[model samples]
Structures are given as structure tokens and as C-alpha cells.
Target chain A: MRARLILWGIAALLLIALPPLATALGQPYYVDLARRILILAIAAISLNLILGYGGLVSFGHAAYLGIGAYAVGILGFYGIANGWIHLLVAIGASALVAAAIGAVSIRASGIYFIMITLAFTQMLYYLGISLDVYGGDDGMRLKSRSQFAGLVDLRDPVAFYYVALGVMLLFVFLTYRIVNSRFGMALRAAKSNEARSRAIGFPPYPYRLAAFIIAGAMCGVAGALYANHTGYITPGLMAWHQSGEMMFMVILGGMASTAGPVLGTFALLLVEEVLKGWTEHWQVILGPLLVLSVVFFRRGLAGIFFKPDA
Target chain B: MALLFEQLLNGLQYGVMLFLMAAGLTLVFGIMNLVNLAHGSLYMVGAYLAVTATQWTGNYLLGVALGLAGTLVVGMAVEVIALRTLYERDHLDQVLATFGLILFFNELIAIVWGRAPLYSSLPPWLQGHIKLFAGSTYPVYRAAVIVVGLLVAALLWYVVTRTRLGMLIRAGASNRTMVGALGVNIKLLYTVVFGCGAALAGLAGLMAGPIYAVQPGMGELILIQVFVVIVIGGIGSIRGALVGAIIVGVVDTLGRAFLKPLLGTMIPPTAAEAAGPALASMLIYLLMAVVLAVKPAGLFANR
Candidate 1:
């Protein structure tokens, strides 16, 4: 635990100093990339809640991200610039959808669960595409950065980067706390053996559903941040590939650990960045690498620092 | 009324296409217990190869044969190289690895075919329309697709029900250990089954090429729908796949054709216009959800 804390502390310090460091090095683009990575790390962390701990392989988690983003984009379209409102709507809407989807999906197990989640997300994606008022398939740009009533101008790159970093750290700590709590124990217990958990007076459905909703709501926040960071939102955000990539991040970071997904997000995106610089057809390389990693790199980058499921 | 009849035919054709994809998917899942997302990649491969071969040989039939053969070989190679080791692993690993394969296939296709959509023209004999009723006319090529799909389904039914291979497949699905113990070559059996599944997907892809834009990611557009069919049909059941695919196809096509005008009469045109297309697109997903709520195992779930 001490080592884990120190590791995160050093990581946090570096992130806090990233903007100034990037500026000094005359690589401002890195700050934007860092901010984007931090936002996605939040998403990866949320995925880990149900995936790593609760053992629910929701292949459509990106739907919540898209939902969260659409909440911000739609409200902004209607001239509601309140950042707090965007955050609230993002969370509330995501939770509601998750509840509905989870209520139906949690009844099924294994491949059925994965496919159901995926289909529902695709349903949402199609809905997003058909909403012409929201720019439909082509997507739309944010009119402006969300206003926070003078707390901090999201337009300022450094300010936004710090905000994203702060939020990411907060979620990492939050997930850590949640994973150690009674609810977390129940969630994990259900994951290892649902039948045993039920025999022990803890039915897995309610616990699993609750975790799914929490993860959805958390990812929604990440989505909201993503909209602001990119200043645009599209239905493509919820595509199955996004969900796949998020899963890869969770697996890459090391499942069931608090900071593992954060590490994962960094590794995946950084590698992709380097590969993009190398060639336009980077996916050809990344694809086989992902396959090989799943086959051989079972423990993930987090496995090097922490024991499995530690 | 004639329009409705024509739309129903469209739905049937679409469903028939879906069954081809779902049959292979369901068979693989039911027998091998492996979820192969790259099954759609095989579909794309078949379409690409057929299009390129058709262009090369100037004979559509020969090109199609070549495409089917190529997909079978690719499927067997994949089963031996990538999937053989995966049967023991968890579903999560299988999903990720196959997803990686999807990325590889899509990009490779793009590199070879370029990003633009490829179009294949039907032969002169298949180019005209067939008058089905007083006012409804369906394309001859589409009619041929329906006929072909039905023929394949019937053939599949016969093979699985009457043939020695079918008996072996059924036995393997129920008790692979016993089948292996009885001196069946399980590894070779898996490869053959996987190859047949790929060929089925390839057939669907080649059929779809003329009607749909053959593009890098075209396989995925239909793959999720195929997943819905499998889910609604009951995983591992060919009968379930057929029924589920038809239901989804009919429901989807009819919903798109009628939902707009139906809604327009009750609500404002603008609202109906916006809601109709969106709801139509989501119709099958909603259906799958309802089915799950009522029958979580699906309509024809044997297990």
C-alpha cells in the first residue's frame, strides 16, 4: 500500500507539472494530448469498476460516454452554458440509461451479456446518427467551452489540463475507496462466484446492476470532459471500437487495481501516438500487437508494479 | 398495398442475407463455444476477393467460387494459428483478440482496395426486374439472392440433419469429449467447421456486395445485427438463427418503411421525420431487449 501510494504520488506530481514542462520544452501539443489521455483515463477507470471488479463485461460502455457528451452538446445547443448543469445531466442521464440497460442485461451472463450491452450501445449510436438537430452523422462542434461561472476558463489550455488532471486523480482515489468498501467486496464476491455469493445471502444481480450504473455514471463524466477538451461531440464516440479500446486499456493497465487503467490509458494512447507518427496505417501494427498482448502480455503494465488483483 | 408487399420482399431478402451470416456465427459459437468477431472480417474478405476476381477474370461465377475458396482457406488458417489456443482461455481474451483481428482486416482491406466503396455489377441476365404483383416489381438480382439464400439454408438443414458430418457436429456440440474418445479427430473437425462457417459468411458478403456498398467497415454494419439475430434465435441453434434473422429483417425493413408515415399522421411531420428513422434503426435492438426480458435464453435455445 505504501509503495502504491508513493507511485501514484510521483505520478500525480508529474501530471501537475506537465503543462509547464511542455511549455518550457515548446511542445504544447503534448499538453493537449496529456489532457485527452487524462480524460480517457477517467473512462478506463470507470470501465474497470464493472469489468475488473464486478466482472460484468459491458461491451457498450462507450454508450454512456456518448450519452454524457451528448448531454453537454445538446444543452449547449439550447444555450445552456452552465458547466454544473452539464455535469449533472451527464451523470443523471448516464445513470438512468445504465439502470435500464443493466436491469435487462444483468439477467444474462457470459457472451449474452457482452452482446446485449453492445447492441444497446449500437441502438444509441443509430439514434445519435438520426438526430439531425444535433448534426446527425457528421457531428457538430461545441459553440464554446463550457462556462463555469468564472471559476476557471475552460478555454485556457493549462487551466483545462489541470482540471482534467484533478478530476482524474479524484476518480482514481474514489475508485480506490469504493473498491475497498463493503459494496466493493460484494461486487467482487459476485464476480468470483455468483452462486456462492447468493448462497452467502448476497444476491449478485442488485450488486452487479449498481456497479454497472456507477461505472456508467463515472464514464459519463469523462465523456463530458471529452466534449470540452475536443470542443466537439459525435456519435462515433460510442462506437464499439471505442468500447473495445477502453477494454484494452483496462486489460492493459491490469484489472482490479485503482491506478491500473490510468497506466493503461497512457500506454495505449502513447503507443498509438508514436505509431501514428511512424505511418498512416498504424492500426495494422497496433492490431497484431493487441492480439499478441492479449495472448502473451496477460499481466499487463500494471502487473509489473503490483501483484495480480492486489 | 403493393408497396407494402414490395417492402416485405425486401425484408425477406435482408433476413435471408442475415441468416447466412448468423448460421456460421451460431454454428461456431454452439460447437466451438468461441465468439469470433472476425467472422464478419471473413465476410468482408469474401466480398473483396470476389469483386477483385470478378474484375480480373470477367466471369462473376468463377470469381465467386474463388472468393468462397479463399475464405475457407483463410478461416482454416485462422482457426489453426489464432483460435486453436484460445478455446481454453476466457471469453474476454477471445473478444479482445478477435477485435484485434477486425482492426487488422479492415485496415488491410483499406490498404488493398483503397478507402472508396467498391461496387459489383450483376450479370446481364440478372439485371432486370421481376413483377411480383399488379404494381410491385422486385429486382431480379435480389430475387436471385433470396432463392440462393433459401437453397443454402435448405442444403444446410439437410447436411446437419441427415449427413454423417452433421451427426458428428451434433455429437460434438453435446459431448466433444465423448466424440473425441470415440476416435473422432476433434482438431480437424474444428477446422472444418470453422471453414464452413467462413464460407457461409463469405456467401453472405458476396451477395451483399451488389446491394450494399462494399467498404472497409461494411462487415461491422451488419455484424451487430447478426449478433441480435443470434441472441434472439438462441445461441448455438441453427433453427434459432433462421427464425431470429427473419424476424429482425422483417421488423427492421417494415419499421423503416412504415414508421415515418404512421407517425406523421399522429404527430407533427417534423417530429415524425426525426423520430421515425431513429426508432426504425433501433427497432431490432428493442426487440432483442424485449425478448431477453421475456425469454432470456431465446426462442429456440436447446440448452
Candidate 2:
């Protein structure tokens, strides 16, 4: 636990300091990239809630991201500049969608669950493509960054980076609290052995569903942040590849551990950037790394670096 | 009415293609207990190889033969080099490793063939139309595809039910450890099964090359749908794959063809126009969802 604290401490210091460090180094482009990482970290953290704690491998988490993004995009096209509405619709729609998906598909275990989630995400992807009014197959550019009634300006890079950081940190704290709560323990127990937990009078469905929805809502927030960061929305955002990347982050960071997703987000995006600078086909390196990580680092980067006194 | 019949045939052809893809996926899952996401990559390879081979040999039949053989070799190589290590791992590890294989294969294809979709036309013999009924007809190639698919299906059924290889496959699916204890070469059997699955996927790909756009990511797009088929039909059953594939294909095609017109009569034009296409595409997924709700083991789950 001491190691976890120090790890969190270092992460906080870096996220807090990075924008200025980036600016001082005359690499404002990196500040933008950092913003992207923070946003993605938030999403991965949400994924960790269900996948890590509850053992529900949702291959369609990107659908929530897409739903959240398209919520913003659809609203933006209608000139709804209220930030609160964007956030609410993102969370609300994502939770509703998650609830529906969870209610129907959460009964499945293992590969069935994985495939069902994939089907849901692909459905949304096609829906996005079908929306000709929202720019259809080609994505649309936001006319303006989300407006917050002068409380904050997203058009400014540093401010946007801070907002993204603040959102991530808030969720990280929330996640820590929830995972340690009675509900989280029960959910974890259920994941480890569902029938045993049920025999012990702890129903698995509601808790798992709750975790699923909460995670979906959290990812929805990240999706909104993502739209504001990139100033656009596209169907590609919900593709399974994005979900796989997020899974890699959560896996790379370490499951059931707070701050793992943050570390993973940094590692994956950083490697991609550095490798892209070296070669156009960076996936050649990345593909092997993913396989190797699974083979060697079962507990992820967190397992390798910190044993956490277990 | 005539249009309906044609659309029904279209659905059958597409379903047959899907069955070819899903059959391999189901077999590997049932017998080997391995979830190979790279199955789609094999499909893509078949398409690419067939396109290239056709150009090289100037004979479509020979090109298809070569493509199927190439896919079998590639599949076996993948199983030996990558998947052999993964059989004992958890589904998560298997998923991640095979996902990496997908990335590697896609990039490899991009490097070799470029990112653009390849265009492969059907041979002249399979072009034109076939009369199915009075004043109703279908594409000759599609009719040929149906015939070929049925033949393959019949061949598969024969091999699985009437041969020693079929008996071994069934026994392995039922009890892998027992089969191994019975002195079967489990390793060789796995490799052969994986290769056969790849050949099926490849055959589907080569047959589809002339119809669908052959591209780097094309395999994955169809893969998810194939997953839906297996889920609806049951993961480990070939019979389930055939049934589920037909249902999905027919539902998807009929819905796309008629839903717009049907909805237009009930709703405003703008709403119908906007929602018609989305709803149409969602038909197969909806079917899968309903089927799963009713039977969690799927329609014909043997495992």
C-alpha cells in the first residue's frame, strides 16, 4: 500500500507538472498529446472497474465512448453549447445504453460475453456511418469547442490539459473508493466464483450490472473530454481496435489496481509516438509487444515494478 | 414477389459464405478450445492470395486451389509458431496474442499489397444471370456460389460423420483429455484442425473476393458478424453455424431490402429515411441477442 501511495504521488506530480514542462520545452504539441493520454486513462480506468474487478471482458466499451462522443457531436450540430448538457447526455445515454446491454448480455460468461459486446459496438459503428446528417461515413468538425459559460475555455491548450487531468484524477479517486467498498468486494467475489457467491446469498447480476453502468458512465465522461480535445467526432472512435487498445492499457497497467491505467496510458501512447517518429509501420513493433506483454507480464507493468506487498 | 425470391437467394449465398468462415471458428473453439481471432486474418490472406494467384496463373480455378492451399500452410505455420504456446493460456491471453497476430497480418498485407482494396472480377463463365423461376432470376455467379457452398456443406457433413477423422474430431470435442489418453497425436490433430479451419476461411475469402471488397481490415469487419453467427448457432457446433448463418443472412438482407419501404408507410419520410438503414443493419445483432436470451448455450450448442 505504501508503494501504491508513492506511485500515485509520482503520477500526480507528473500530470500536474507536465503541461508547464511541455511548454517550457517548447513542445506544446506534447501538451495536446498528454491531454489525449489523460482522457484515455480515464476510459481505461473505467474499463478496469468491470474487467479487472468484475471479470466482465466487454469488447465494446468503445461504444460508450462513441455514444458519448456522438452525443456531443449530435448536440453540437444543433448548437447546444451548454457543457452541463453535454456531460449529462454523455453520462445518461451511456448509462442507459450500458444498462440495456448489461441486462441482456451480462448473463453470458467468457467468450460469449466478449462476442456480444463486440456486436453491440459494431452496431453503433454502423449507426454512426448511417447518420448522414451528422456527416455520415466522413466525420464532422465541431464548429466550436464546448462552451462552459466563461467558467473555462477548452480552446486554450493548457487549460484543456488541466481539465482533462482533473477529470481523470477525480475518477481515479472515485474508483479507489468504489473498489474498496462492500459492493466492490462482493463484485470481486462474484467474479472469482459466481455460483458460490450466489449460494452465499449475494446476487451477482445487480452488482455486476451496477459496475458495468458506472464504468460505462465514466468512459462516457472520457469520451466527452476526447471530443473536446480533438475538436471532432468520428465513427472510428468506437471501433473494436480502440477497445483493444484500452484493454491493452488496463492490462499493461495491471488489473484491480488503482493508478495502473494511468501508467499504462502513458506507456502505450508514449511508445506509439516515439516509434512513429522512427518508422511508419510502428504496429510491427507494437503487435509483438502486446503478445509479449501477455506472455511475460501477466500482472502487467504494475506487476513487474511493484509487488504491492501481496 | 419475384424480388423477394431473389433476395432470399442472395441471403442464402451470403449465409453459405458466412458458414464457411464460422465453421472453422466453431471447430477450433469446440475441439481445440482455442479462440482464434486471427481466423479472419486467414480469410483476408485467402482473398489476397487468390487475387494474386488468379493474375499469375490466368485461371480462376487454379488460383482458388492455390489460395486455399496457401491459407492452409499459413494457418498451420501460425498455429505452430504462435498459437501452440497459447492453447494452455487463459482466454484473455489468447485474445491478446491473436489480436497481435491480426495487427501483424494487417500490417504485413499493407506493406505487400498497399492499403487500397483489391478488385477481382469473376470469371466470364460465372458472369450473367440464371433463371430461377418465370420472370425472376439471380446472378449466375451467386447461383454458382450457392451450389458450391451446398457441396462444401455436404462434404463437411460427410467428413465429420462418415470418416475416421470425423470420429476423432467429435471425440476430441467431447473429451480432449480422454482423446489424448487414447493415444491420439493431439498436437498433430490440433495443427490439422487449425489448418482445415484456415482453408475453410480461405475458401470463403476467395469466393468472396470477386464480390466483396478485398482489403486489409475486411476480415475483421466480417469476423464480428461471424461471431454473432456462432453465438446464435452455438460456438462448437458446425450444424449451428450453418443454421445461424442462414438466419442472420436472410434477416439482414430482407430487412435491408424491405424495412425502408415498410417503415416509410408507418412513419414520416425523414425518420424512415434516417432510421431505415440503421435498423436494417441491426437486424442480425438483434436476432442474435434474442436467441441468446432464450438459449444461452445457443441454438445447437454441443459443448
Candidate 3:
């Protein structure tokens, strides 16, 4: 337990200190890329809460990202650029959608749940494409970054990067707490054996639902950060492919481990960046790489490195 | 009213195309207990092959036939090379692998054909419109699609219901181990089954090429709709694929066609104009959610 605490402490310190150091070293682009990785890591960690812990293979998690992004773009477009307000609205909108969608989706298990979530996300994609307002298929651009009350300057890339890093660390800490808590145990038990969990006098449905909502809210924050980072939002943000990519990040990193998402996001994004630079048809290489990883490595990179307690 | 009828027909045509793709997906899932995400990639290959074949043979029909045959071969090859190993793996693994295939195929296509959309036209004989009642006209090509889709549907129904192969397929879906114990060559059967699914997807792509732009990433666009069909109709049931396809196709088409006008009547025109398209686009998802709520297994779950 002491070892675990020290590991987490080191992780937290690195998360806080790495970006400023990169900025100090005159590698602002590297810091920006790290910020992007952290943002996606935040999203993937939320996904792990339900998928890794609760065993719900949701294919539509990217829809929450899209929802959160649209919230920022739409609210900002309407002249409400307060950073806190936009973040709150984004989280609320995503949570409400998750609650409504989860109520129905959690009814089915296995492949059915995956397909249903994918279908709902596709519906959202089409909605985004068809809406004439908010730039429709072309996507809308933010005139400016969200403004804070005399404190944070989001337009500054360094400040924004730090904020993203802070948010990611907070989410990582929260996920760690939730997974180790009593509620977390119930969720893990449900994943192991639903009938056994039920026999032990714990209902899995509400616990799973709560986890799904929490995950969605967390992803919403990532979505807002993504929008701010790019200063643009499009229907493609909610596409089924995006959802698939998010799932890949979780599995690629190491499902169920706290550091898994962080590692996975960095690896996946870096590979993508490198591949895109090498050739336009990088998917040819990357796609097979993904398949090989799944077929060969049942345990992800974190699994190979950290060796979680049995 | 005539215009409405035309739109309805258009929806049916689109649904029929979707049914072709969904039928193969449902069949493979029901029989093999495998979730094939690369199913869309197969659809894409069919379109590319059709375009290539047409250029080679100068006959659209022959090109389509070759496309179907080529896709079947590729399907079997993929099953033997990649998917055969994935049957016992978790769905998460299946998803990741198949997603990889999607990327590979998309890039491969881009490398070969360039990233621009191809203009695949119909034969001169199939290009004109057929006159319906009064003076209304519908595309002759669309009529051919409906006829071909119905015929394929009938053929699939016969294969799944009356034939020995159908019986084996049904048995396999229920219990693979039992079929293996009974001395059936389960590996060969899975390959053939996956091949048939690929052929069906290929057929859908070939037919869709004329109506929708045939491009590198076309498969990904239709893949989600096919998933919706299987979800609503119940996975692994061909009959369910048909019904679900029609329902989704019609609803999506009609919603896009008249949703704004329908809302305009009930609310402020400006508000209706603003919200109609968004609501219309999401109608099918709403339908899927409601169906799942009422019947968690599906509308016609095979098991």
C-alpha cells in the first residue's frame, strides 16, 4: 500500500511539473502534444470506469465527447464564453444524455449493448450534420477561447495546456478513488460475476448506471478541452469511428489500470503523428498493427510493465 | 402525394440495400458467434472491384458479378488468415482487430485508386426512368435494385429454411460444439458462412455505387446503419434484418423528407425549421432505444 501511494505521488508530481519544464526547454509543440494526450487520457479513463470495471463495452462513448464539444462551440457561438459556465453546461448536457441513453442501453448485455450504443452515436452524428445552425456539416469555429474572471488566460497555449494537465490529473485521482472505494468494489464484483454479485446482496444495475454517468461527465470535460485546443467542432467528433478509436485507446493502454489510459493515449497519438508524417496511407500500417496487438497481447503495455496485483 | 410516393420508394430502395449488408452481418453473428467489424471493409472492396472490373470488361453486369466473386474469395481468405483465430477471443478484441482491417482497407484503397471519389455510372440500358401511374417517373435502376434485393431476400430465406446447409447453419448458431461433435467440419463451414456474408456486403456496395458516391471511406458511412438494423431486428436473424432495414430506411428517408413540414404545422415555422432536421436525423436512434427498452433481447432475437 505504501509503495502504491508513492507511485501515485510520483505520477501526480510528474503530471504537474512536466509541461512547465517542456515549455521552459523551448519545446512548446511537445507540450501541446502532451496536452492533447492528457485530454484523451482523461476521456479514456472515464471509459475504463464502465468498460474495465463494470464490463460494459460501450461503443458510443465518443458521443459524450461530441456532446461536450458541441456544448462549448454552441454556447460560445451564442456569446456565452465564460470558461466555468461552458464546462458546467458541457458536463450537464453530456450527463443528461448519458442518463437517458444508459437507462435503455444497460438493459441489454454483450454485443447488443455495443451495437445499440453505436447506433445512438450515429444518430447524434447525423443530427450534427443536418443542423443548419452551428455550421452544420462544415463545423463551427470559436471566435475566441473561453474567458475566465481575471485569472486564467485560455488563449495562451501554455496556460491552456496547464489547465488540461491539471484536469487530467484530477480525473485520474478521482478514478483511482472510485475504483478503490466500496462502490468500486461492487462494480468490479459485478464485472467478475453478476449473479454472484447479486447473491452477495449488491444490485449491479444502479452501480453500473452511476459509473456510466460519471464516465460520461468526465469525458465531457475532455470534449470541452479538445474543442478549446483545436478551436473547432464538427459532427465527425461524434462519429462511430471516434468511439471506436476511444475504445482502442483504452484497450491499447491497459484496461483496468490507472496508468493504462495515459500510456495508451500517448502511444496511440504518437504513433499516429509519426505514421501521418511518413505516408498518407498510414492506416495500412496502423490498422494491421492494431489487429496484431489484439491477437498477440491480451495484456496491454501497462500489463506488461506494471504487473497489477492478482 | 406522388412526390411522397416517390420518396417512400426511395426509402425502400435504400432499406433494401441496407438489408443486403445487414443480412450477411446477422448471419455471421448468429452462426459463428463472431462480431466482424471488417464486414464494412468487404463492402468497400466490392465497390472498388466493380469499378475496376467495369473498366476491364466494359460490361457493368459482368463487373458486378466479378466483384461479388472477388469479394467472396477475399472473404474466405480473410477468415482463414485472420478471423478464424478470433472466435474464442473477447468482443473487445474482435472490435479492435476489425477496426484495424477497416483502416487497412481504407488506406489500401487510397493507395491504389487515389483518395478522390469514383464516378461509377450504370449501363445505358439501366440508366433511364420507368413511368409509374399517371406521369410520375422512377429510375429504372432503382426498380432493378428492388427486384434484385427481393430476389436475394427470397433466395436467402430458402437457403436458411429449406436447405440442408440452412439446417447446419441453424444448428451451428445454437451450439457450435455440438455440431463439431456430430462430425461437421466447423472450420470449413465458418469460412463459407463468412464468405457468403462478404458476398452479400459486396452486392450491397456494387448496387449502392451508382446512387451514393463510391469513395475510399464509403464502407464506414453505411456500416453504422447496418448495425442499427441488426440491433432493432435482432442480431443473427435474416428475417429480422429485412424488417429492421425497411423500418430504419423508411423512417430515415421520410423523416428527412417531411419532418420540417410536419413540425412547421405544429409549432413556429422558424423553430420547426431549426429543430426539424436534428430531430429527424435522430428518429431512428430514438426508435432503437424504445425497442431495446421494450424487448431487451431484440424485436426477433434468433435465440
Candidate 4:
């Protein structure tokens, strides 16, 4: 428990310190990248809730990112610029979509769930493409960054970076708490053995559905942050390939670990950045890298670095 | 009326094309219990090979034949080399590994064919329009696609129901250990089944080349619809794939084609125009959701 508290303290300190360090070093680009990394980490952590803890390998989790992004983008296009309002709309929209979809999707286990989630996300993608009002295939651009009512300036890189960091840290802390709670125990039990969980007087359905909704809402937060960061939103956000990438992040990070998603996001982003700089056909390299990771290093980066305590 | 007939033909053609894709997907899942997300990559390979073969041989028919052969060989090779190792693993592992293959194939295609979309022209004989009824003319190639798809479907049905291989396949799906205990080489059977699935996807890709743009990301686009078809039809059931594919194809194509006009008759024109395509595109997903609600295992789930 002391060690856990120290780890959280260090994490909180790092989150508070990093952006300022980047700005002090005159490396604003790293700050921006750091901010982007935090947003993805938020999404990945949420995914870990369902995938790592609940053992529901949804291939379409990126749909929540798209839902969150579109919520912000569509609302902003109609002249709502408050960051809190956008965030609320984004999370609410994602939770609603997740609930509606999860009601049917959570019925099927394993591969069917993955495929159904993927198919539903694609439906969202096609809808985005067909929406003539939202720039259609070209995508919509934010006229300005989201506003925060005199508390912070999101348009300022440093301020936005800090805001992202603060939010991410809060989410991480909350996730840590949730995973150790009664709900988390039930979720983990369901993952290990659904039949056993049922035999023990716990109905797996409601817990799993609630987990899905929470994960979706968390991803929605990431999506809203992403739209504000990039100042653009497109149908590409909801594509099946994007979902694949999110799953890749969860697995790469070591699904069940607390810090796994953040670490995985950093590793993947770094690899992508470095490889793209080195070669035009980096995916050829990346494909094998990902395959080998699953084949040889199934425990992921976190598993390699930090052995979980029994 | 003519327009409606034309749209119906278009829907049928699209449905047939989707069956070619979905059948392979369902079969592999049914037989091997493998998700095979990279199946679409095989389709892309088929289209690329067809384009290359046509250029090399200077004959469309020769190109088509070579494309099919090449895809079959590659499919078998992939199964023997990569997928064989994956059969014993869990579905998540399978999804990840196949997804890796998708990344590799897309990049490899881009390297070989360039990032630009390749334009594949139909042969002159297949290019012209044919009159079907009263004065309505349809593209001969599309009509040919429908015929070929139906023929393949019939051939598949016969092979699955009337042949020794079909018996083995059914047995493998239901009881793999029992089939193996009977002295049948389960590994070899899996390889063959995967190869067959790959070939089907390849055929779909080759046929889709002239209809849709052959490009790096094309596989990803069609893959979603194929998944929807398989899900609604029941995973691992070819008959379900056919039914699901046709239902999705007709709904998607017709929805895009006449949804606005149909809605305009009932609602205001502006709202109809705005909502038609959006709702149309969502029809299949909505259908799938409804199906799942009623029958969570799917409509024709092969036991």
C-alpha cells in the first residue's frame, strides 16, 4: 500500500512537471506530443477496463473515440464552445451509444462480439460520411479551440498540455480505484470464468454492460480531447482500422496492469514516429513487429518490465 | 419503373459480390474457428494479381485465371506458414495476428503497386450493356457477376453437401478430435479449408476490381460489410452468409438508390434528402442489431 501510494505520488509529480519541463527546454513539439499521448492513454486505459479486466475484446472501441469526437465537433459547429459542455456531451453521447449497442452486442461472446462491435462502428463511419451537413467526406474543422471559462486557455499549447495531463492523471487514479473495488472484483471474476461467476450468484450481464458503458465514456473523453487537440474531425476516426490500433495499444501495454495503457501508447507512438521518419513503408516493419509481439511476447511491455504481484 | 429495375439489378450484383467475400469468411470461421481479419487482404492481393497478370499476358481471361491460381497458392502458403501456428491460440491472438497480416499486405501492395488506385478495365466483350426486359439495359459485366456468384454458390453448396471433403469439413467443425482420431490429417485439412477461403476472397477481389477502385485501403472498406453479413447470417454457415449478404446488399444498395425519393413521398423533401442516405447506410447495422436481439447466436448458427 505504501509502494502504491508512492507510485501515484510519482505519477502525479511527473504529470505536473513534464509540460513545464518541455516548455522550459524550448521543445513545445514534445509537449504537444506528450499531450496527444496522454489522450490516447486515457482511451487505452478505458479499453483495459473491458478488455483486460472484463475479457471482452471489442475490436470496435475506436467507435467511442469517434462518438466522443463527433459529439464535440457537431456541438461546436452549432456554436457551443464551452469545454465542459462539450466534454459532457461527448461522454453522454458515447455512454448512450455504448448502452444501446451493448444491449445487443454483450449477448454474444468472443468473436461475435468483436465483429458486431466492428460492424456497428462501421455503420457510424458510413453515417458520418453520408452526413452532408458535417463536411461529408472532407471532414469538419474547428473554427477555434474549446473554451474553459477564464480558468485556462486551451488554445495555448502549454495550458492545453497541462489540462490534458491533469485530466489523464485523474482518470488513471479513478481507474486504479475502480479496478480494486467490488465492481472490479466481479468484472475480473467474470473474465476468469463466466459460468463460475454465475454459479457464485453474480449475474455477469449487468456488470459487463456497465463496464462497457464506463469504458465507452472514458474513450469519449479521449475523443473530445483529440478533436480539440487536432482541431479537426473526420469519419476516419470511427474506421475499423482505428479500432484495431486501439486494441493494439491495450495489448501492447499489458492489458491488466494499471500503467500498461500509458506505457503502451508511448511505445507505439514512439515506434511509429521513429519508423515513419526512417522509411516510407514502415507498416511492413510494424506488421511483423506487432505479429511477433503477440507470437513471442504475449505479456506485452508491462509484463516484461513489471511482474504483477500475487 | 426503369430506374427501379436498374437499381434492383445493381442491388443483385452487389449482393452477389458480397457473397463471394462473406462465404469465404464464414467457411474459415466455421471450419477452423479462426476470425481471419486479414481475409480482405487476400482479396486485395487477388485484385492486384489480376491487374498484373492482365498487363503481363495481354489477355483478360488469362489474367483472371492466373489471378485465381496465384491467390490460391498465396492463401495456402499463408495458412501453412502463419495461420497454422495460430489455430490452437485464442480468438484475440488470432485477431491480432491477422490484423498484423493486414498491415503487412497493405504496405507490400503499396510498395509494389504504388499508393495510387489502379484502374482495371473490363474486356470489350464484358463491357457492353445487355437488354434484360422491356427496354431496360444493364451492364453485361454486372450481370456476369451475378451469374458467376450464383454459380459459385451452387458449386459450394454441392461440395459442402455432396462430397467427402464436405463431410470431413462438417465433422471437423463439430468434433475436431474425433475427425483426427479417425486418421484424417486435421492440420492438412485446416490448411486446405483456409486456402479455399482465401481463394474465395481473392475471387471477390478480382471481380470487384473493375467495379470498385483497386487501392491500398479497399480491403478495409469491404471487410466491415462482410462481417455484418456473416454475423446476421450466423458465423460459419455459408447458407447464412448468402442470405445475409443478399439482404444487406439489397438493403444497402436500394437504400442508397431510392431512399430519398421514398422518404420524400412521406416526409418533407429537405428532411428526406438530409436523412435518406444516413438512415440507409445504418439499415444493415440496425438489422444486425435486431437479429442479435431476437437470436443472439445469429439466424442460421451452425451447431
Q: Model 1 off-target regions past 4 Å?
A: none
After superposing candidate 3 on the true structure, give the runs of residues whose Cα lies further than 4 Å from its correct spot: A5-17, A20-25
TM-score top scorer: 1
Cα lDDT for residue B291, model 1? 97
- Model 2 chain B, poorest ten-residue lDDT window? B129-138
Task: For model 3, name the residue pairs that clash.
Answer: none
- Over 4 Å off, model 2: A308-310
Q: Looking only at chain A, give the TM-score of model 2 against the true structure.
A: 0.97
DockQ of 2: 0.76
How close is every model to the real structure, measured as TM-score? 0.99, 0.98, 0.97, 0.97
Q: In DockQ terms, which candidate is top? A: 1
* Model 3 lDDT per residue over A1-310, tens place: 6766687688778867877788789887887788888888889999988888788999999989999999999999888989899999989999998998788888788998888888888888888998778899999998777788798998887788788888888898899999999999999999899999999999889999899999999999999999998899999999877888888888888888887877788889999999989987888999989989889977787787687521
Checking candidate 4 for backbone clashes, the offending pairs are none
Model 4 regions lying over 4 Å from their true place: A1-15, A308-310
Task: At residue A92, give the lDDT of candidate 1.
Answer: 99
Tell me which of candidates 1 and 4 scores higher on DockQ: 1
- Candidate DockQ values, in order, are 0.92, 0.76, 0.85, 0.82
For model 1 chain A, where is the 10-residue window of minimal lDDT?
A301-310
